[model samples]
Target: MTDVRVLIVGGGLAGCTVAKMLEDEGRGGDVLIVDRDPQAPYDRPPLTKAFLGPKDRMVQSPPWAPADVPWLADCAVAVDLLARAVQLASGRVLRAQTLVLAAGSLARDLPGRDNRVLTLRTVSDALRVREIRSGGAGCFLVEGAGPLGMELASTLADDGASVTVVDPASAPMERLLGGALATEVASWAAEAGVRLRLDTKVVHAVPVGDRHAVEAVFSDGEAEAFDCMITAVGSVPAPMMLHGSRGAVGAAVVDDMRRLVDVDGSHFEGVFAVGDLAFHRDADRSLVRSESWTAAKNDGEAVGRQILGLPAAAEAVPYFWTRQFGRMVQVLGAIPLGAEVVPIAVVPKTGGMLYQASIDGSTVGFVGVNAQRLVAMLQMQGGAVAEWVAPEV
Candidate 1:
């Protein structure tokens, strides 16, 4: 094996997995992971659930193991890609043969949303949300109807707080889960005393005394208020540091087929990127977007294998899961919004629905709750979301 000294930027799931894979492959000397956060890499998904809940469900892991390997626990200010040197905030420059850009993405905030609006991206942010939530019964306004918003609403609802999830879609998770599962999720929320307002848009957020309220001057001039607010709308690539990198956007740009940076594929020899920061393209050069932990793990491992001169693994499946109101929601594939959706299954009285997406007779993605095993089985059977199967209730 070539003595390839690897400098990994970003300390989240992507960086951690890459470092672990390298060590597991007995290539410790070829790896060094750097992260801006002082604390070790921790899971971010649970922040909206167990960590923010009353019980103890926090899971922790060191960014990198073994005292011999170095983990630069600080922000990387810049990267001298040509010279293969990474400049840290502490004025330290580290050299490496190859660099993996996995800085990940940031919480996409709503327009006019203030910093007072809670976001659950990092541990610190999660702690703040938990503190505010545990203080007392308060109203929360979640700006998006995505998985994070639903999970946060459920956690807050469990804590005896009213959560109002706002989204542009006509129904909660309508775009991804389709009408059947979205209705099931909405029913679950209603049973839990959580309010779901579809087709609503927020005009702006204003402070009322010590409390903050959002003015939802919708298309019809309607308004609403809440004591606290949290934005789980979405996430965008956090590639602000790669401004100087050639053709690099807010995230590092990479060609999926070539597995190299967008710098002509010849500028930085042997350098590759994975995870959220890596702007990747598929066979048609169509951007493949994913920011889940599983995607990061798969991407990191693929890059590692490629570095080891192994055949590239199959295109990584983008798998992710969410928990809301004690229900386990897992998605294995990407359900293209506006695509044809069909319901697959619905349990007896639980109102759980399984929906799949199909594009030109090819199953692409699926979304379901309490049916992880079923979904796994379907995927194993070469199922691509061909159609949405209604609940056979």
Candidate 2:
């Protein structure tokens, strides 16, 4: 059995970031990274954006070299907390002084069996979708109007394919952007030549013929046939591997410190969870999980620092960004459902717009379209919208 001071599961952004930070702090020699994927860690956001383009190529991060951190390309099947060891599919057992779970999440698959339908989550999944799209102009139906779905639809439309986006939400990203921005995005989709089927749900997707096509059945008893179908319904946490004497096989519970909590509400010592699998407890004792890339990176860095007995990193404000319909949308902080939105600036020449969302006269969030500098300045200043001079008409 191989023994290590720290064993990190999952090779995605969170795991890699932690390993890199530890190495930079002169603690790399005692770390081991185990990942199921054979390929080196790569940027994942592009799988639904730039990677869909015909001329784009897969981008991978450089492997660990200076510290030469040990990497085990194997799947961890079971975790024996009592023995402080993990069993891998290859019949290898690894004992660790500390275990970090960054297993991430898996893409939710569409209901029913239809080999023609695809879902994008991994590099291999992106390659397969790109290959199918390169076959020529054909009808593509994308389920879910969230960021991934919309981005994929935009890319497919730009590639000369007929794209249709179906979602149960009133508008694209309604929950995140609220009504005003969602409506604007819907218009953007229309202008980009992508069809929007809002307030609609796809019941199932079944093979329609022998020509690699799928017929998607809707909640309204309407069926639509398309050359290809992709589901971006969302993702769920990956299967948890830990097992304890108290029968806590997959503890989704986590304390504010990001430590896995047992069924009895006690945190396990020497164990930590990060990324999508972590259920972080807020100051109010409410558990919330952040699936954003930035959140995962912050979680890793904070956890690494804590393990090294160093000062905790400053908490990062929630931030997210995406590109669709040739427009870059950036958001910071939470904008409540009924928040008052005030337009701060509009630059027609640059096609930029900025808005500040406030509740009870205190700014809570900022949304910008192609106005990155203004958004960054507001974010740094921290509270209430700053007065700005409007550009001369």
Candidate 3:
């Protein structure tokens, strides 16, 4: 009889974490990891902040890895669910008892955007950005105020280039951080000498003489131009492989514990899903699909526990952070529905702000800038904000 195995697709954070855990558990037999990139898995966070370096280089390995594990450096082409096999782009087939998808996502370029634009999703993309920006002070414009775009903006500004960040929203990070913290971030951007263009939209981009410029017509009909454009709008799951698979929803399907694949509901058979791809048809699906790395890593660990037939671990606080203009901002836990925002504290010396988001008089979440240690401290004390009103600092 052929031995059963595990096949993990997309060697991003989730896939690699799961593979390493399986290997450590002596389940490495017949385990295979397939990914499109040839290089060993490395830290993607450095692709933005660290590479902008006064003292940055590729550095060393991250916290996780199983040195002897088997991996195939090929993109997955198809999932033969019936045969329990994964098909690679090179026409190779590998059978497994379990298949995991951590294929991740690609940036969602605007309607008229093309290859002339740059993205920061992978290590190679980051290297290209460094090479182009390092040539000298070049005009840089970043679209969106999310983590990737904001970090890139900070990197460029620190290198002595005039940077302009344009977003269609009224404030820099309202969607993720709420209005109070967003205003604080906008203030920090101005103080750090980064140009801000809010409620702005791009109309068209064209090459002019020796340089490229995008003719952007903002919502107010003000036209603007920029030499280089970078986008960090967001990402969608790379779900092409699940188009014809049974029991799949869009790019992936999830179970009660948020595993990725479709298991037999009746018999409770084995299957799993993780990362950005996990979803449910319930009311909160939209927010559950944030696609951030923090979400992906937590889902990865959850699925690992499930494979071992252990009870699912408690869901994490669901956090994500960005370092821009040397200020650290993070969002922890779910944003309460119709929550009113209140200012907790703002340190003028460091430009860090802490705000509590409350709904129906209960603190549901908090957004902090340069206050990660403080935020963790708050969460550790039985959800600190709930215990008492803010004491004057």
Question: lDDT by residue for model 2 over 152-226, one digit each (tens)?
Answer: 998888877899999998878765665447768888999989999988888888787675588888888899899
Off by over 4 Å in 2: 53-56, 62-67, 282-286, 382-393
Best by TM-score: 2
Task: Write model 1 residue lDDT over 1-393, tens digit each, in one string.
Answer: 112388888877776676777777788767877887776567777777775654344546544433344677877777656656667787788777877777777788767877777777877777777777667638888878888888888888887888888888877766445443666778889998888877876776766556444444554477776778888877887643443346342446666533545455443555566777666666677766666778787777777777777887776456788888778887766665565667777755555667667667677777767776566665564423344232333
State TM-scores per candidate: 0.85, 0.91, 0.87
lDDT of each: 0.69, 0.78, 0.68
Q: Could you tell me the lDDT of residue 271 within candidate 1? A: 58
In terms of lDDT, which candidate is stronger, 1 or 3? 1
Q: Supply the global lDDT for candidate 3.
A: 0.68
In the range 1-393, model 3's lDDT, one tens digit per residue, is 222477777777787778777777888765677778776577677777866663235434566655667877887766655456666778777767877777777777787776666777776777666777776537877888766777778888887777888887776766676544566677777776788887776666554436444555566667666667788787776654642334543446676665544344321234466666555444654535656678778777777777767787666666777777777777776664356777688757676667788878887677777776667676565533456344333
Cα lDDT for residue 145, model 3?
79
lDDT of 1: 0.69
**Comparing 1 and 2 on lDDT, the stronger one:** 2
How many residue pairs in model 1 have overlapping backbones?
Answer: 12
Q: Backbone clash tally for model 3?
A: 5
